[model samples]
Target: MPRRVGRVFRPGSLADVKGRPTRNTVAGALLLLLFGSACAAHKGPTSNPRAERELASDLTRVFGAPVMSQGLWGVEVKSLDSGRVLFEHNARTLVMPASNMKILTLATAAETLGWNFCFTTTLETGAAVEGGVLKGDLIVRGTGDPTINSRNERAAAVFDEWASALKAAGITRIDGAIVGDDNAFDDQGLGAGWSWDYLQYGYAAPVGALEVNENVARLTVRPGATEGDPAVLELAPGSGLQAVNHAYTGAAKSAVTIDFERRVDQPILIVTGSLAIDAQPATRDVAVVNPTIYFAQSLKDALIARGIDVTGGAVDADDRGDLPAPDARRVLAQSQSPALREIATVLMKVSQNLYAETLLKAAGAAQGGLGTTEGGRVATRALLSSWGIPQSTYVQYDGSGLSRYDYVTADLIVTILARMFGDPRHKDAFVATLPVAGKDGTIASRMKKTRAEGNAIAKTGSIANVRSLSGYVHTRDGETLAFSILANSFTIPAATVNWIADLAVETLANFTRR
Candidate 1:
């Protein structure tokens, strides 16, 4: 490592479920459908009485390990094929689910928006383009397109394409501002019950209709040439925020430690601490403030970089008045995001929080309502109700489980699994999104070479003292199983809880009726 700190900043920063037969709540009712209808219709992979007892014993030992003694655990495992509850402990208790919340968010979105739904972001203008000059403000209207981010592409690729399209259309200069119309989503950016400390990290990024780069900017810090010299700093998407470097290089081979801070009322990020001259460069991503403005400014910079003349500066539509109505605008450029299935894959595979939130708001907008978190919640609640899953089983404060206020029962999670697994409309697309054990996604390195390896596909969740793993696995006898394991208030390391959960899954993968 040549100590390269190539960050985007001059200074920047960085569920449950259970089963069966109760009609008042959908959790149990859905279980009956997965089980009862199957038994009445035909023979499925029935659970063996002796095998169930052995599984109970194995799971008890796995969860009873001393590492889990201090934590509160909730788990449920049921056969989607046979419709029998294989194992459950505290399955109905409400617990914080972390990113597992994305499951519910994506499932509802897939149902509401359909598999092929795509988000369209457009560049519109109310004035004419004459003699290579755009006479008025160029507005960018977004419909909560999460794929506009640079998770796997250049930060300015989308904007650069738009500028090229403009030049090809004989538009070389803009006479007015480049305004961002992020009105599709509300002004509330941060999720409910999120801690203030999380504001500086990229994962706690704000949500907006015009979000770019996932509302995050990376900060890179490198050691100076010699000891006691000021540390070098850089930021990506450098148009938005400013960085104040207070860090210094230390002696060669010394330890590297750095801290980033942004005061409550300040617009600048102050980087403090030191890095050894020979140490590798460090990088971190930090959330930006007022993401709508960030998106507008970034687009403005991209246009300028592409040899386009921008006589005016970037502006957020919320800060301006006298804008044209929707019908009065003419589109100059547009970007269509990948379909919902692809978007949902990113959401589940990496557990992208902004994606979950963006999709939720988009769902609300698609339902003929303003795209607000409350509206999203209403849409999701209605969807859950339609499935007969009782609203009392889960309390969703935000699409991502990043909010500590979000809670759900193991029973509810399994119900979601069973429903998605059994849904003819979304089964393949839905299950394909989960991370595979010992193969891909967040759990790529877990359970390698074990019976669970490549056999378990699940969503993993973690936040503070909470840890969760819920998904599906196939047993040795070829029985398909849906399961959820949640551990909260644990004193042990999160890896310990994950180990126990992985062990439990491995145990399930090893089960055989013979």
Candidate 2:
């Protein structure tokens, strides 16, 4: 038997109901059903289960091929809107993150130190001036700022300002040596875990409490005729650096090879090359073996040229207690830069190793410790933990991620991205620092033509055996998702690994939400 409410049939019509207005009741029931369905739809899709399975299949197929080598890899993708894990595989496995570790360092710095932080460099006198002849050393205090490099013209300007200040103080001569105060950091310029082979190269530029010109000298090489003749090695004029050239020449078309070795007994630069005279000039930027001494000497010379005579050679070490009192003086000059946020953008975008390392040290120094790798790690971890992120997952050795010892999981990185996306205070700064696919930074040539090509913004990591990509992507449906993919121990060349990673990202971009 069927019960019905209608206008025409008495048995099946609303009028068939004894003493009740069936039309009004039927209308109410219909409206209630529509409202419930609308509410369910408004909740949105929780997870794309089918899409997750397909993504897993794609990864297995790509890496399981006979030609592919075995490796530890992980991938995780989460929907930003629903906070659901759409896809995940071994997301807890820890592996070397390489340069990708810079993300953590930068994020911690931005949050803890604030983006407007700036470092200061100051000059102090050690003795009272009597008739323009000071009786003690001139102290240059370093605040452990790493931005003071040879490439920075502003640093040179700062040096000039110091000279002007001395002149204004009516001090024309010093009876003692110039002391470099580098006590802001530990004496270990290079970290303990860094490889010995890297020390001789510019890339291993030792971390210094007082860094000048990135603690390196530029040597321009011009090939000389005959194998025995010395190849012309020109140092930056007035750099006060002495070079011992052992470079030799060979026949044309032969490749040039350069090797440097740092002896435990004494640090020395050993140059060897077989470049031909007709070949292009080779230029090498070698790290300054002793940055503190280098800076002191250069400053001494500059001061001497300005009619301020230094009685002795420059010496390295702290002289805070020995400095004279500050006199009433107006600001002679000041150098300003874009806020810390903008500076961080360059650090992350270009993968600037020096900048990252320096910023970490600055944070440590701000937190009551001599700026060092260990100090920076402690400070960075504390910052991340304060943000409610679990610090147990990350192992940070150096800020640049140049060490093979640093390890971080993909899941943790994606977690960070998710937070930054939702955090109004840091959202813009963090996103702007990431490299854009097919446009800039490490991803300038990656993920071309896929939905992720122009829409994805990420940070890339690469080392001898590690390749990682992590960041955010805007989907076709206007949904922003966070993802991280880390591949390690691939037997193939880095180029091939990059190709596979790009493909994975493309698949994620094209996936349809169901």
Candidate 3:
């Protein structure tokens, strides 16, 4: 008979080290206490009779922790290799998905729009260009491309390219206004159910058919030389916005407090607060009031800087009454964004809300008739229905989970994962977009030094009291598992809930059926 090698302790038991402890004995106990879960990660086959029983009990204990008892949880884990349910808890219940909603939006977009899809923005004009001069407006028509941004001077770089294209086409001067035609997408910039308070931040930047620098204006605030001195401020891609600074420099080592107020449909950005004289320079990116005019004004500046003279001012197509018919206009220059697969990678890895919203509208225009939020929802619903997912199981208000109205079930999330896993065309591309544990994207710093590190890939969601994790992981025995963990209405700190979810994923990553 084999001898018992190690002792086991029940919860809160110290019998294993009851006697006077030796130096090695105390060290070993400390190691065990610190890495108890890491040790259990090397356990036997997760599906074996004994292992499965322990996994169930372990997972139950984890979700049943005192802090989690008051919260609602919807969890589901399954083996993709054998199509077996590994574990589940309230899997069918609806819960806030937060950024997890991007999974569904991106998956639908990948299938409906195809991986090679790209957005095209064109510079068109209806009038004649004679003697190096255009007789009418230079219209910039946008097709919901979110790539034309001013981050790191990228907008100027892209605009320089456009200027070159224009000069190459024999367009040295424009006689009319620089107009932005953003009719491809509806005029509603903000998403449904988005908080009004979040409007002032860059993350909540408005969505539009014509996006410039992600529809945000970057501001650099420098402290004045002395206390009570006015703070210095500068805006990037400076156009269509007016900054009113009421901020001052504070005493050395003082707290830095900066606040801004820019109401919707307004161009005046009121800056108020104080920055410590010794504080490092501060930077803030605020949402622009109108993306169309922003793009138009930016293009106009780029054109003038490139020696292409424009006599008229910048304006939106809707604001102008006399616009040429679509058929009568001719394309002068155009810019095509990167492929959808690359765009999806950025969207999933960073959980970019603007990209999510734009992709939804783009899919709507591609499959349905119009490029609108509701159209995207209808298209997504149609796709989900084809996969046998009932509409009652999930409610999608916006492509990005920014909408407080969005809700989904753990079952729905896993079902989408399983479907994507089974599709040969999209399997590799879709999975490549998720954030790997301790590797990259939003979860880069999470699950480090654990079995899940470099082994699990998932999307994380967080908004107020809601936290979610859902994606794929390969077990120790090489069996692939898809899981979803949604926790909502938790009164505890978000880090506490995140710990619970990470522990659960780490458990799955260490699972084996050897």
Candidate 4:
């Protein structure tokens, strides 16, 4: 394997789950005025190293990789008040971004769809209720709501509510198949450049307009009663995926290894591994072969559990455009997703890849009359371009940064962050969606006792060899600084990369311009 370190450097720098840690407090502003007075009174022609070497030195201390190594680091920071670049390192060099790609996907969606937009899932029947019986197919239509399995796991209960709604409308039975409409999005379950190994996991689940349980099924495995026996396996929600378990019970002190896999678009899951006899039961979440069909079947079962008779098996519908238009179908029940602002809030606070991807496709479908990854990318670039962000600055292959082909620069990230902060309509709600340091989201447990605690708000990204953190940091000097630090192809562990990134952010939090 070839190893190379490509990073550009100049002087200057580098650089919440709706928890408004920065929103409720402005006393720091008053303190800033006083601090300004103090600086003016005693400070004289202060030539701070911040202009030349501080950022470079700080970053170098954290990353000790050699020039010929595989490590690539990029740092960019700017003053929110003035869009001046303070530090630049490989600022224009493109590199893979992990989940940091969500920043662009989300920021673009916020601009294209407005902050208040929401997704709708509706249930309708072609025939009217005729005394206890739905005369025709019970149709469920979705516009890519990713919350069905996440944030709230009561989506099936919501389906129960839909069944009850039908019962209240004098329908005792559904005479036809329960149809799932996922045509809002093109049937590209996985993103470009995603690994097959990851595709079988929940985080890389099927991305359809309609999804149930995040399009994943949970499998629980427990050791057998004695050594050398077959382990016990169970599946959740009664998904029809047949499991071929090759797992065996091993010695009590032996390591427990469980592997879950299935062929592309296949319904049979192969489990190969072993569990220690004395090992505790473990659960694994794996992606479903077909999300649209899984959703239809799930709703079918939920309705049946609620006493609604669904005579035929659940059928999945690929596109709503092929069916009768909304005005033409007789609507029976409807479910609306939480407001876009709330969804975005959870999306960032949780670093939700599914939500981000669905929102990307949804934006494309709404704007260009087609819901696909390509359309979403076009819509995102068009919206950001209209806002003065040139598409040439970054190469985006997927909404989520799981794609190794996706490349972006830290400088562009900081540039966008600064623009978002200056956006009068979106600054508050948009900033409220990021993870807060030592408070909420992914960074809740980090930087608790430091100056960055409750003050640093940022997005985190991770992959095997890459880790990234980008966002705003409220400085002790009362100025909000935007920063992006991206490290790719490192030989170090993810924790080490994250710790280095945290050190960088803490440095920014304590930065004082002389």
Candidate 5:
């Protein structure tokens, strides 16, 4: 028989055909046992070990690429199912997060303040109201609610509501000027750490207790033809602000530099610019100096335009004792948002700086006296610490990540994401706020062809030289993954940074557990 290539075994017995012939059946069984052990050694780990290795290899290839040279970059990814780190690279390194800082602020708010939290704006009376007529001052108290003027139409609509309420109350005339009660919050309308240059722009407008139309005024410019002629500038409707037009006409080829400044005491509007008559209409939204007075004046104008008469102009706290109170108690109209969760979702998805700042102040006001950004920051930090997050990880100077000084690590963000996922009360709200890859928010243009496109929900951050992405991604194996990738001092352009973020997300989607 062709030298018996192998031994023939029957049940638990084996036959040895080699030089060492086995006279007993037990000897053959020993030979078979050795064969089985050798085969078992070849099979190790899990069913998908090879797949896991391939996925890891792909991630390393991208990270090690020459294009991504940087100051520091870190990535941390963990599986929600197994609670194991799937991939990690310097995950503990601290770096400037840019707009990604909003993630911390939003997460803190959602954790401390529930999803359904709503802000209240009350019309309180400093004096008594008798027979549908206030005997003293009318107080419109601001609890530091930031959603005061999210939209122009909404702001105008609110004024109409207040006007109707005043008319229905049968108070056609007022004995004193309307008083704006913004003392609910401190006088530090702007954050101490905010930069002066940012304050001059609309994005960095100061947060006030009595905010109207986002405490902004629109200046519409219509340039006059011919050289040396002045440009005509007009204010938007219901904008009780006055401007001194210092804009002059210049050569058609000359570019105009517009300058505007608002002082607190006198509140003078100074506009200086050189305009070419043929240029497109220029428009600028400048922050109002005193939001309380602006709102008071706007309300008075609206009421007067609606046929109601007022005896006095808008007044500050000093004239509160002399103003008449509301004659009737009617809600008139109430402006409510789509819930805190929805707001948070937008704020995180777009990295909305203003919304985050406003939410911070609102939280502080809810805790106690006047709402303030500093108070809000303190409260937010304390709340996070109580939730088991390390205080050192979050270096939040402002609600928005506009400040370059703000810093956060990928590891800290991952920790926060994990905690939020574990909490049943906050799980939905927190998850909903993250940007869906290739669909909406900042990630709308990212992760096009990977499993992460619709499955990965994260927040994006971008500045001059920094880029970051942090959130959750559900793997193909039904495992939820939490990850954060932060890159600083990136040598590539912003578009390239985004590409790297997209690539990392794609890699995570393809990751498989062994």
Candidate 6:
């Protein structure tokens, strides 16, 4: 008989995680105390149940007491072969997935648009330059390529390519304005239910058909040479942002608390707080107001550096689904983003919000000719519906799961994982994207010294009061299992909740069939 473990231990509080405490508070703590004592007495697997009996015991022990009171968890684990369900606890309950929602978004993208799909950005002109002068605007169009960043290219190298191509096409000077056209996708910049707090950061960068450097401006801040002096500020790929620094340099040993904020309903970048004299320079990446205009201006600057000056300034065309007709002139140069599989890998491994949103809009654009979130939501549901995943399992709200409104069941996540494994065409490409426990990506520090180390591939998610992890694991008995564990409405520390979830996965990895 397995010994009953009656102890309920809670580690840390949720007060440390920025923007996470709103979901957990004193009221939540009171609720936890009320029901935790009762939940602690519950049992699992009354009879002898093979490998899962121990797993149930472990989960039962963890899900009891004060920790469980703070948050509700939905967990499900199923065997790929033999069609056996290993464990289930509130598997059908809808919970916040956070960034783990990327699993479905990435999967849908890879399936709807083959893994090899590539987004293209092209350069065209309505009128060709004669004698190094063009009378009309130089139009640059993008088809939802998320690359064009410093990671892939350096120092506007790609834009320099565009400039060279323009010169090669017999254009030494652009006498007209440079126009940026992103009509391939709709004008919807932010996701549905996205709050302004999220829209100001790079992670919540506005999505567009054309994006450069992730549509953000990096603000580097360095303390002044002496105390009581203002800190120095600089913006990279600076286009439409204006930062007002109200920060001051403190003593060499003074406490450092550098901060940046955008006041209520204002587009201004307000910098505050303090920095030490000897402290290293820090960077804050903020989302730009307009990505299309930024792209246009960036190219304009690049052309100027390449000795091609424009008589007129950059033009955005205020693309509100009203784009000018394509020019009859031939294209001068083009830039192609990496294949969809590569982008998917980054999206899952790092849980990138910008890339996920871009892919979501791309899906809608592919299916409905409009890359709006609604269009993507319709197509995403249909794509999963075709795979037999019901609409009831999830409520589609936004890409990247940043919105608090996004909800999904653990059972649905496991089902999707199982189906993806069965697909021979995308099994390798899809699974490779997940973070390997104690080895790579988001879970690099998870499940260390346990059997699950380096053997589990999963997606991790975290928000205010939410934390989740879901993916595939191979048990000691050589059975492949798909699992999803989601938690919401918790008042405890997010790390402790994550530890409980990790223990559950480790138990699955160590399970024996015999």
Ranking by TM-score: 1, 3, 6, 4, 2, 5
Worst 10 residues of 5 by lDDT: 1-10
Write one digit per residue (lDDT tens) for candidate 6, span 126-219: 6756887876788888888888888657437788888888877778888888788888887777777677666668888888887888898888
Model 6 alpha-carbon drift over 4 Å, by segment:
1-48, 154-157, 237-239, 319-324, 327-329
Candidate 6 similarity to native, TM-score: 0.87
Please provide, for model 3 over 1-514, each residue's C-alpha lDDT reduced to its tens digit, 9 standing for 90 to 100.
Answer: 1111122233542335467775334423432432233433443334476766666777887788887788999999987767777789999998889999999999889988999999999999998989999998999999988877743465677788889988998999999999999999998888988888778778888788998888887788989988999999988663457889999999999988988877566777888999999999888988887889888888888899899999988798999889997788999888888889888988988898899999998888887466998889988999999999999999999999988899999999999999997787887778778887766788888887776765678999988899999998876565678899999999999999998898888887676565
TM-score of each: 0.89, 0.80, 0.88, 0.86, 0.77, 0.87
- Per residue, candidate 4 scores C-alpha lDDT tens digits across 1-514 of 1111122231231111333434223223222322223334432223455543665565556554453156888888776644456567788888887888998988878888888887888897767677798877788888888777644566866777798888888988988878887777888878899887677777888688887787888899999888988889997653558888888899987887898887657677788799988888878997777777788888888888889888876777653335555578887788887788888877787787888888889878877676888888988788767767777778887888888889898978987787777777877777777887766788878775676766678898887788888998755455567889898877866776777678777776766664
Q: lDDT (0-100) at residue 390 of candidate 5?
A: 80
Indicate whether candidate 2 or candidate 6 has the larger TM-score: 6
lDDT of 6 at 497: 88
lDDT of 5 by residue, 1-514 (tens): 0011111132332322345543223322332332223323433223465665676677666666677764567888876555666677777777888777787777667755678876556554544445655555555666545555644366666667766776676665555566676776676656545555546456666666676666776787767877888888887543445688888877786897767765445546677887777777788987655667776777667667887666677766644554334444333334444468867865787676667777777777767876777777888788778877787776777777777777787888788788777677777667767777766778777775556655677888876688889888755454567888888887677787677667777777656554
For all predictions, the C-alpha RMSD in Å is: 10.4, 15.1, 9.4, 6.9, 16.5, 10.4
Off by over 4 Å in 5: 1-57, 126-136, 150-152, 235-280, 318-338, 449-451
TM-score of 3: 0.88
lDDT of 2 by residue, 44-131 (tens): 4446678667766765665454544577677788877678877777788888887788888887788767878876656665467889
- Overall lDDT per candidate, in order of appearance: 0.83, 0.69, 0.83, 0.75, 0.67, 0.77
Error of 6 at 102 (Å): 1.1
In terms of TM-score, how similar is model 4 to the real structure? 0.86
RMSD of 4: 6.9
Q: Which pairs of residues collide in candidate 4? A: 8-89, 8-90, 13-87, 16-433, 16-434, 16-435, 132-172
lDDT of prediction 1 = 0.83
Comparing 3 with 4 on lDDT, the higher-scoring candidate is 3
- Which pairs of residues have clashing backbones in candidate 2? 6-13, 6-14, 149-213, 150-213, 215-288, 216-288
Q: Which pairs of residues collide in candidate 5?
A: 132-327, 136-323, 136-324, 136-325, 137-323, 184-370
